[model samples]
Target: MRTAALLGAILLIILGLAQGDSDALGDDQPMFDVRKVEIAGELKYSDPNALQQYYDQLLGSGLFDDSMGNLTNFVTRPPWIESAKVRRVWPHTIRVSVVEHRPLAYWNAGQIITAEGQIITPRRLPDLPLTKLMGPRDTESVVLDQFSLISQMLSTSSLRVAKLELEDRGAWNIQFSNGIRVALGRTDILDRLGRFVAVYKSDLSGRIERISSVDARYPHGVAVKWKLQE
Candidate 1:
């Protein structure tokens, strides 16, 4: 018991000395210059050169003392970054971790939209062959919601959508990966697609090369246009 008590007392004394050292160099005691900075995250679309330059200028700023406000603001402002966390490695090093936006589909032409309907226009589009979704700027949520529903419905098929468009007149159209276009008109879009799918499972998919377009505006049947065979 005596030895244990002595060891406990020594540990407490050591901890106190360490705490004093921390107090001498803590955030409030003295502001230190950033000598090293590490960025940790799976970043693909964000430019690494721009990131390096950004950090260089930021660390050079004497005003970047201990507050994470500057770093967080700077990192999150980039279109690809969803959120960022900043931490100090005690003396001269700062670490930044970031979460990126997941691009669900391409919007308009150059813009990409997240699954949550947030639009981002990166400097360069990713090389991914994403499905395109188009609609008025005000109808992003509506269009995105419909795209999710349509994509989920098509997931059961052997094929996938290449593009989806919603015109000002509320007409909907989808182009499948096999380059077959389907006009869904205004209402009952998925129901129309289901009708078309029945034909596809029974007939069309095997003859995809001969099919150019499908008009599903009929309540009971769909119209198919065949390609000219040479």
Candidate 2:
């Protein structure tokens, strides 16, 4: 009787092991058949078809296979994509959430072209309230490089920019929110802007009504033009 009981116990254990293995195999099988894809947070700049094309490339390349690890790493790091998330839902669908980068200002080609020369198009067609920058058609890259400095200068005060133009002669001009224009000449732009900050802090704070223009091209001085009443 004892021998029979031990043999029966061994048989039960083997059966349990087989059942566990079967369950594990089932869990490891691929879950969903990815079909429809949804994208969100594209804003005004992202092209739905272009984004879909990118995903199709990934899927067709077998990059989505589980044996290859997470497929999201490739999708989220693209230059134009600010952020992205991928989700698999149901057996026939996938969803991709994307946040696209919007241009804060245009460089070189009016408000029509991005800093990279990609034409800027918003979903809603209306005039952009952001600053515009223009430079030589071929010099857009240099202008883009200088955008960081220009952006930093604008951030220090209430002076908002409507447009900033860089002439082919290297001259720089900025139009402000209050109908004021500023000319910072071609040399030592950082130093010239610094001087303007000092003057704004001392002479123009809370006292001036409207300034038509300021010339910071001159060394050791900045010229101001007050707007005349019409």
The candidate scoring highest on TM-score is: 1
Q: Please give the TM-score that candidate 1 achieves against the real structure.
A: 0.80
lDDT of 1 by residue, 8-93 (tens): 99899867765766744555433445667788899878887777667666563333564677678876888888889988775567
CA RMSD of all predictions? 6.5, 9.1
TM-score (C-alpha) between model 2 and the true structure: 0.54
Tell me model 2's lDDT, rounded to 2 decimals: 0.66
Which tens-of-lDDT digit does each residue in 73-138 have in candidate 2? 656554456667777654345667877666656554434554444544444333567667678766
lDDT of 1 at 15: 70
For each candidate, the alpha-carbon lDDT, in order, equals 0.83, 0.66
TM-score of each: 0.80, 0.54
